[model samples]
Target: MPKDPANNICQTHIFEGIYNKYSKGLHDFLYYKYGVQTNPKDKTQEAFIKLWDNCKNVTLAKAKSFLFTVANNMVLNEIKHQKVVLNYQKKPQRTYTNETPEFLLEETQFLEKYKIALANLSEEQRVAFLLNKVEGKKHSDIAEQLGVTNKVVEYRIYTAFSKLKAELENFNIK
Candidate 1:
């Protein structure tokens, strides 16, 4: 079928039409590739946004390639950044067969301090961080529950790390 020339990437209605047509597939793609750690919906939106941004250059026929490429790139970016978001996920405690009693005592004390440090974070940051690390939620899922975008969730997680890093700068958890 010939694409409607009017439905170029620059046209809002056309762009939305493409979004409506492919959003689910794009989402499924992200979900399958990134699992629950990332948000496919956000990536889909980002891909569409990029299409629109370069609308004049994009055609309805070429839309699929453009969207997939953009979405894939976004997913790759997320995978690359996973390490930074993981600062919130530390081992609560690790036991050794020949550990010293003094080491155990100090470990317990450090955990308490860590908890206190977590408690001090802004609610938004704390929630996002914990949901990602403790609950093992994807930014996409957390964003849906909180009625925010995945990027917002990412920011919250990032800020949480910044705050925790500053607060717990002195201690090195083992």
Candidate 2:
């Protein structure tokens, strides 16, 4: 049927005619492509609203094309947004510790003092001490790495511990 040229889609009756003609097809298109989960009915209504908003730019001949295009794009955008939300939900949540501020400050201060104490050690003593304590090596293994006797390795480690104990005595470091 030939539409009246005088009454554009911006008019209530003409707009209603366009809605009646294309709303169902557009809704079905979105439903078939993305399913009911994507809210095809709402998207179809939104598309018609957009058409009305820009009715001056859209002709009766182009109204069907405009509705389908707008509805399809809206559904695709919503699907992409849902995927992002799902991916975010799947990520591992970060765990936060409930340490008090004073305790955290004390821990930080102790670490700083410990670093200074380690720095104060003689190179030979530091090497043997770290290889044994930090790296979990035995005195015999440390002696082999340092090309020294086990007794020498033991002496260096013992001196390192004694110095560290004295340096960190105020903090009660073991």
Best by TM-score: 2
TM-score of 2: 0.53
- Using Cα atoms with residue i matched to residue i, what is each candidate's TM-score against the true structure? 0.45, 0.53
Global Cα lDDT for candidate 1: 0.83
List the candidate 2 regions with Cα displacement exceeding 4 Å. Answer: 1-7, 101-174
What are the per-residue Cα lDDT tens digits for candidate 1 across 35-55? 867778788888888887888
Per-residue lDDT tens digits for candidate 2, residues 1-174, read 544666588899989988888888888998999899989999999999999999888888888999888988998888899899999999998776789889999999989999999999999999998998888999889989989999999999899999998889563323
Off by over 4 Å in 1: 1-7, 84-174
The whole-model lDDT of each prediction reads 0.83, 0.88
Question: What clash pairs does model 1 have?
Answer: none
**TM-score, prediction 1:** 0.45
> What local lDDT does model 2 show for residue 119?
99
Clashing pairs in 2: none
Q: What's the lDDT for candidate 2?
A: 0.88
